[model samples]
Target: MRERGFRLIRLLEYAGLLVVLIATLAAAGQEIALMYRQGRVTVADLLMLFIYLELLAMNGIYWRAGRLPVRMPLYIAIVAMARHLTLETPDMNAWTTLAEGGTVLLLSLAVLVVRYGHIRLPYRDEDPDNIGGRRS
Candidate 1:
């Protein structure tokens, strides 16, 4: 029964992921179409496309690995913050701009810390049941 439940849950996860992947592709296509209509691509358009690419990569990695890395979302967040600041800089107040810049910096530092931890303290086992690879 437990195994059956896990299987069902995994099926739902795959379905959800497939939906997200399709939606992302559609959005990217729309963005490209809009750029074509405008006859030129701007920095904001490029950043938005880059975000889509990152989402696709993240989806692919999750599908293959059965696990999502913490860094992938962090990278996406950093790019998103940059994009937001770029688009809003003209009208944004000084404090708001500083806050956004600080957020990007913090996310970058988080990525570095996660990378360091993964390298310095590598996982010894792939078993999910084995917490931290410590034997009971």
Candidate 2:
């Protein structure tokens, strides 16, 4: 019964992942269509597409390995902040711009720190294919 319950949970997780992947792809398609209608692609549009790609990649990694790297969401956050700055700069006050930029900078620093830690202090039972660092 426990095993069956675990299997059911895993199935639900996979179904949820499938829904997210499909939604992300559909959003990307809509964004592309909007770009076509506007007849111009700006930096903000590209950044938005990048966010979509990162999300898809994150989903793919989790689906394949059953784990997610800590850095993935940080990268997404950095890109998202940058996108927000680009989209809002015109109407935002100088202080607001500075604050947003600082947030992105902090996120970038976080990514660097996370990468450095992964490289400099890896887990004792690290698996190249697994992010969970589970011992076998």
Candidate 3:
């Protein structure tokens, strides 16, 4: 029974991953179409595209390794906050702009911390075949 439950949960996880992959691809396609129609891409659009790419990367890494790194989401968040700030800058108040900038700064710091931890303290049984390989 326990094994069957585990299998069921795994199946659901794969199904969810499939949904996420499809949604990300569809959104990316839509963005590209909009850019094509407009005949030019803005920085905000580029930042949004980066967020989509990061989401796709996160999904791919999880699908391949059965684990999602903490950094991918941080990268996505940083790009997202930047995109928001870019799009809303014209109408945002000074305090709001400063708060958003601070949010991006905090996310950047989080990425640094995560990277530092991954380098200074890693999993004991790290997989040799993984992309970064085992860290000493």
Give the Cα error of residue 55 in candidate 3, in Å: 0.8
**Candidate order by lDDT, highest to lowest?**
1, 2, 3
lDDT tens digits, residues 1-136, model 1? 8678778988999999999999999999999999999999999999999999999999999899887889999999999998999899999999999999999999999999999999998767566456456686
Off by over 4 Å in 3: 125-136
Expressed as tens digits, the lDDT of each residue in 55-91 for candidate 3 is: 9999999999877899999899898998998899999
Please list all clashing residue pairs in model 3, or write none if there are none. none
- Look at candidate 3 and tell me the lDDT of residue 95: 97
Give the clashing pairs for model 1: none
Q: How much lDDT does each candidate structure score?
A: 0.92, 0.91, 0.90
TM-score of 2: 0.85
What's the true lDDT of residue 24 in model 2? 99
The TM-scores of all predictions, comma-separated, are 0.92, 0.85, 0.86
How many collisions between residues are there in candidate 1? 0
Return the lDDT, model 3, position 37.
100
Model 1, runs deviating above 4 Å: 128-136
